[model samples]
Target: MKESGLPDRYENDAAEKLSPEKQLSPEQQDLKNAIKAFCIAHQHDEHAVFLIEGDAGTGKSIVINSIFNEIQSLSRSSDKSSPFWKTDNYLVVNHPEMMKLYKNISESYPALKKKDFERPTTFINRMHKSGKKADIIFVDEAHLLLTKSDKYNHFKQGNHLEELIKLARITVLVFDEKQVLKFKSCWSQGLLKSLVRGLPCQTYHLKTQFRVHAHQDVLDWIEGFCQKKILPMPQKQTFDLRFFADAQDLYDAIKKENARYRLSRMIATYDYPYRLDGEDHFIREGRFTLRWDRSKPDEKLPWAERPDTIDEVGSVYTVQGFDLNYVGLILGPSVLYDPVTDGIRIDTSRYEDGAAFTGRDGLQDPEGTKERIMLNAINVLMTRAVHGLFIYASDPALRKRLVQMQASRDAA
Candidate 1:
């Protein structure tokens, strides 16, 4: 029973996790106020879909949580017979780490957590079985929601995205298209329109970044870097960007910094093979030998956020949808900077996301599909740092290309 992936002790620990209050930026507050009004106004509507879109550090989570808490407060204040009071709502996420975070948080807030948090696949399957649907659903990290039916979710009839939105009268999604890490996940204007072809829909965007401080230059640099846009040569002064020739040195620096200040992490590309098992396995690169985090024996905080997990490296799954004080990133073999083309080239064969390569859903473009997935993964890893980011490129030529591109004095 313990091997089923959901164990009794896990549930017990999940019930004890804490969620603190978040101070919202003016933009996050406005968005939350607007969405709260909309939800309350149409509390009885059986078919409304609203999209709240933003890139990383844009306070999407704060807005979502604020709106949810406000709604829950209003609901409890009203009499039970009121439509707003009796309506059931949920906050669904696709990432397991985030789901665990919210579920543990919900443990503290019973008024909100009462059947209120879940993964999309699990929520959809339960709704199908019980013939029940939510009045409203808040989907964070909607881009990570899967479409392809995996081994565990093969019983579902169609796309989980479609099934999810349809199960709610109003589905509010916080999304970023570029954050789609796997080939099966998608969140786009086209997808929303197709899912609800005839229904009128509303949209919102959060432009102000609330995560990383002094984040615009870092974001701009990332945009230009990923798009292959040759902007003015980058300066290391802004947000502490540095590229290193050695992976070990970069990791050691991150560790030293972490000792002074916690919450720093080492994250890397999925160019190396990874599995959740093997408690003893370690990734050996350069002088640094690091292990991927083993599965959580219980439902608690994520490996990336835990102090004890300092030695274990994080991949796309553990680090996405979260921020760190500093990040030491290793760009692996699958993504390489091309000297001939003067741009980056994604080698699909070198990537290790096996699900993307399989023709599981019978729609496989091979190179194009895997290339997009790999690029998206890198894009996510690059943006997770709040104050500092150091990088080491495994491919020497790519490392040299990066050095020449920014060629910061820090490196010199």
Candidate 2:
């Protein structure tokens, strides 16, 4: 009897009841104005830099887009002779795409250097050299900024973010530090923080979550790790686990219902499949293809290019920037649960080394690192669903811990 296509629940009600400005917290509003003011003031002061940092679902992208709009408005009002090309003023640097996502830039900004536009690094550098330093530069998912290393040669390690800082007076780098799921050499908040250390930079934190309904209670759980303590798990029995269940049953039900859930967004976090013993590749209840086509340098092997099916399920790494109406998560053994310590651990040794865990077994880690990783991965995975979450736990103890955590928080 469940009708679906994402949740209508209170999402529309919330939107209808709240004005756009009212939707944002006072702090968020202040930050918006401050950002706008900074751009207006530093429009003439090239090399002035600004940084915006916040965790996932914090409206970072929204803020960046707003500032870009303001800059465009201001540019049109200014003299036409300005050397800074308006088209090049707003640069979005992100990972390489199999699909041609940057084509609009070529058509919209004909002045863009054809050669440089193909690569993020080259395009960013060319814009920097153009002397306008871009009135504002917005980098999405910036936590993935590469630090200098042998593996990545596209941009100088450590310098790419630094150079972006140097190139623009007002640069807003929006990313979630928690998303630094992988501890790569290039991972350093210090590089970004250092750039705006002493300047007029005032860190603005957006803690109000507009994404999930107040009844959902997931935000309360995620607050355990966010920088701003604005959201803490409220002790309430109002938590709803009605839509969640074991991965197999959940997938079967979804398939039977023929509901409206994207296959790609239904994700799974498996324990190290490596120790499973016999299987060459693992398959879950849902329909999905697992291919180990020799992992590409930047792409994860056990992942897909994009959401191609309505019943898609993928690993944590593949679902970072995506979201869905309902999420079906198969939590594998990559995360270890220590019953004695009541802690979680994430084994990352085989992550970059291309170790494939194809069996029912998982990996091992001495420290609680694997647990922490698993917890973080769960946080990310569960948050992806706007309406519902279905988690398939391979580890019973871990599942008990999660349920207990949810219960204790709700009861509190």
Candidate 3:
């Protein structure tokens, strides 16, 4: 079924409205100005590239959309004869894999169809054919952009960043360096930092945690951990598993707290070895979800049609771009980390063989690899809530860490 045919529950309204209250914070405002200035100065330039960096829940998506809106506004305000007014056309190239929007688009508009909507190359070619260079090209969740080398045989030398820049005169890349997982990149923070080593393009960072409430103090603690490299104590003696236990319990809790804090409705994030089966409460059935991990080649998670009721668990990827009033995170076993060793590691061996599997950025700190992944995952997870957070640990060590953190806070 096309987008219209799909149920309203699955529809995403993130980009639907420009919030009346949507005013830029100082940091975001500075970055917005930089984008505006660059476009103004390079109105006639062949191409320009910008790299936007932030951790999860940093408002990167909204910021990028706001810039486009501003560009549109400026175009209208400028004199018709001014080049700025003429360069009003823009393109927002979202990572369809990150959001299932493209699939719906292709189903709705057959002319703009792609066999594999998740592949970056599909969007790359579409931009290339647009003919008129876009005023701005936004690559949301850009951390997933594949490196030029990883391109399939058809695009052996394909670089989504370069192709996107080629499609637009001004290209704005939106990404969280900490969320780099699915795809390797040559246009990442490391590459941009080095490439723009002495360049004049201005860079800005968003430090405010706007998505989460400071009520429970968990958001602050998590932010402190991510930015300061120190894990702060939780507010309780035991990590609350309210939302992660079972669907009925989570629903009851949400109903009880609905007056004080609203829980986000069911958002089933597709992940390895686990995917929701429509109405079955099992992972094997009609759900159309797909999980891409090399390790689980033999493993096929079940998927079914949408259930009448929503589920509580989600993958880190799907939930990163969204925020719930209160979130309950179920940390999958694929991740492994050690607090004492300060060692972070991900057993990416399941994805590929030896060094090649983890890619370049992944090579460092292979032992506690999941720590950084967990760090990033937790950052995305905890920040998704506005009022409160409850982390449910499946792993013994992780559970211990949560318990200890809560104990320390109680003792204090």
Candidate 4:
């Protein structure tokens, strides 16, 4: 496999690429500067929102971190004329794993403290109880913010973004509609626009794919598959895309890659049984059997970064918003191939993540909504690979179709 042209640290942890000291592409730098100007212009405005829209692997997190670091620096500066002087700001993420990364990244910058990083619920409740307002608030993975009340997380309010806007002078967030995985956090472009309808808002889209080394056709193939269309595999070879007939072979390939590249690991759809309770849940395929990711009370690293995680299978919850140098994806029982329609099908009945479907009471179409969430989970898992993507399907028909597609591509 060819090198991804990224530093080793970035390959090991996706959050490392979001460091303020890292270099950004020309387009990313320009977006950062524009956002800074927007924040400065609206520093005292009644309400303002800047939405940074992009797909996975578009370097949205890097831009958000860079802009937040500059905001912190200017706020602490002694210059009296600076608009950010003596201002208060915070960075929030809805995902716990991603929050862990942001907090770890804070140790490298003197201007950014671990206190400055918080989960959305914690930040919202803090501001609400204290009646304290922030000057600028940066949100990463805004799509994961709760759209409905999730009492388990202690977010009584229905909309997190709305409450966040009320607590800040200016709110900047990165959103990808495809990454919205659950009914509670369900988001659409229309819903997002509705929230900031009356506020002074600006939207910017980052089109370039910065994390994945694959060509455009390869990405299109992945997107088409997620949309239930199995298009012909692309013939170009800039990135590695492979299909394995057996689960053991896929695991062996991933192990070889992990030994050579250091960040390769296997991840599966939430079709298999798994829960947060203290018990071992295993995914057994043929001769291959491995346990699902376990919570380690004393472990400081995220699931993907933990040294022992290579021996386990990760789910969307643990790997979303992160990158892997090479990812071995297991398309579990819920994902099926429909021979009649010559398309993909999502069997929601086999999906084991019941929490994802909780609170679907008012949904206009519960079944359709569930299907979309399942597809979104598959999309997030497929797009995580930085250099290569290896796939294995548990459904026999799907596995056969994928193998035939690969064979045809090779023959061409």
Candidate 5:
């Protein structure tokens, strides 16, 4: 029997080649220069720590790639005598899809290879044993750093970030608190203070968004909606942001959009149990049905870059570090609105990400961790679309509530 995998999806690509937005905004450029300078100045010192705090679409990948190319080019141009030429830099990403994508294009980047791109713990373990400290380590999706050993990792631990700080002469980390999907991530600003410990450290925020061409109004709605902040949904925007009354309508629209424009796909919350009985349709409601693409551990093709994945709905693990043109989001039964509280309350028992939750070294509040993961998972899917977003709720009350929220402004 072919085994099934996890259910979920997310927005932001960890690999630069898969990133749609290549051009860097001014803020991203400035951050790149700052990052370059920090690395250059600390070529021989192991006390440099820089944190880049940016939400999704702040051109973090673009900036990191630019600096990498610049450094590699400078190294190549230097006549082999310059210390700049000897600097060894590694660009690491914590997401699996991102790592897989990077390996496919690693040959083009002479400075980095499929081997250099790795999870935080593996990178930490390998570097610790290398004897020679690396000149620089660039961590993308830094918030996904794992703090414990599980089935995937058997490495001895302290913390992933602390190892990078100790072993690398210079470290560049880009993180957003919202992107902390799994568990045991110390990527927060407060954690940075304790980790750096008086080292010459600095933090930079990337404010210019280069993803999601949809208006800020749509983005604002996504934020408030996920947090259950009781805000009205977007009425009008540069791109489509609408709720479909029926799942069938949204599914039809998604198929039409895929036929017209390539790369459109549906991503859903972990509401349904994995249909492992060799069924083609993983999700079915009345006339609406779809199959989520299960992760093939050996598959090298990244879902976002592959054109054949249109028939397969993506999971949070596969799409977390990527983007899509138009997204059809299914807010699963795990999340719903309570009329009494008039706010969102996640049914923790219904959520499916508990298997991935690591807790505070296996000593955390399981219920709380599950809720956080569920919210982050849906938030990732809701924000995946660059041009448009269509949403369908699994819970009837929540579906009606979203429609009411969208039409509330009209009532006013």
Candidate 6:
């Protein structure tokens, strides 16, 4: 993996991997070809949407990136017979950090330009104001697209997916319902399908696991935990899954892993207080106190790539959609163990990230939705580790239960 927490296949120097037929798994290659065929067959269609659905680490980004690279290459080719010749195309991602990584990768290839990447809001407003439409548009992290009008983001159109489909002849996007992190950008499979109901649309589901090398049992354990089922930790000798009682010990272990593996870093849930006010904010858990990641206005590298960030704790906003060799996850106070019910409980009142719950007033079962969002945040943080996963929970009962689960697995 690259220092930026991206897989080496996506490194700027790995330009050859961007080719459609190179370095892609069979599943990824098939999806890329399918998307390519869809775009060509529907080039003149009024509106077409191709939805790629996959869990985190299923190589959705790889497929989309390769397909976009091929599109750009063919569009700029001298062959006039090529259907993609001189086609106006762009790639937009809702996350700023992921956008930086995409722009960085674009610099290494001649066919791609840094400007080809944009935020969904920027691309939407720009196209609206300029009265220009793209031939094909690729959206990464489409799950982050705003489902409702977010004035804070300067997006008044309400639904970004709907607008993107209108502004492009064919819109290809990757979505994961599990990764939807906030109420403002909340999305569901049914809602996504409803948006493209009248349009020409096709869906593809990727089942391969390209990111996490852990066993199927380990993945199942994580899924069960995220779904509120506290299952026993699986025994996996190849993939390290450790539970730490002390937050400081978890941080130390993560640092050692980073020394051995360049891409390892520590991340936490949004249970700590933080803001982008150009000041330092810290996640205080007993003796383990580390500052939350800050927004670097002039930094070109992603949060995990920067050398100094090793000393900080990353939130979902910084590490989502990225890879890390080893991840030390700090589950904050919002996550608790309800012994009475013998299940996991999410204490929504303890969550410090109020922004996540903002604009959730009209939503059905607002409290339940908020709880699910919190769980999703934990799911994203937990899945970031490619090689190993180390966890520290702030709630004593929850941490004790996790320790017991690990102990039982070790005994077996």
Each prediction's Cα RMSD?
A: 7.1, 8.0, 8.6, 1.9, 6.3, 3.2
Residue range 183-230, candidate 5, lDDT tens digits? 665244566678888788778888765567766677777777668655
True-structure Cα RMSD, model 5: 6.3
TM-score of each: 0.88, 0.67, 0.67, 0.96, 0.88, 0.95
Q: Quote the positional error of residue 45 for candidate 3 in Å.
A: 2.3
List of clashing residue pairs for candidate 1:
none
Instruction: Give me the runs in candidate 1 sitting further than 4 Å from their true place.
Output: 1-20, 78-83, 228-233, 359-364, 404-412
lDDT of each: 0.71, 0.48, 0.49, 0.88, 0.71, 0.86
Rank order (by TM-score, best first): 4, 6, 1, 5, 2, 3
**Model 4 misplacement above 4 A:** 1-12
Q: Cα RMSD (Å) between model 1 and the true structure?
A: 7.1
Clashes of 3: 16
lDDT of 6 by residue, 252-355 (tens): 99998787666788899998888778899999999999999988856888887877889999999998888787899999988899898667899899998888
Tens-digit lDDT track for model 1 on 108-171?
A: 6646763788878888888988999888888888887776666665535557767877798888
Candidate 5 stretches greater than 4 Å from native: 1-21, 80-83, 109-112, 184-187, 275-281, 359-366, 407-412
For candidate 2, write residues 245-270 as lDDT tens digits.
35567666545323433332445664
Q: Candidate 6 — which pairs collide?
A: none
Compare the candidates by lDDT and give the number of the best one: 4
Q: How many pairs of residues collide in model 5?
A: 7
| Candidate of highest TM-score | 4
Return whichever of 2 and 4 wins on TM-score.
4
lDDT, candidate 2, at 124: 54
The list of candidate 2 runs beyond 4 A from truth reads 1-29, 76-88, 96-120, 125-132, 150-153, 185-189, 214-217, 223-245, 253-258, 261-264, 270-307, 349-375, 400-412
Give the per-residue Cα lDDT of candidate 3 at 321. 68
Q: What does the lDDT read for residue 52 in candidate 1?
A: 87
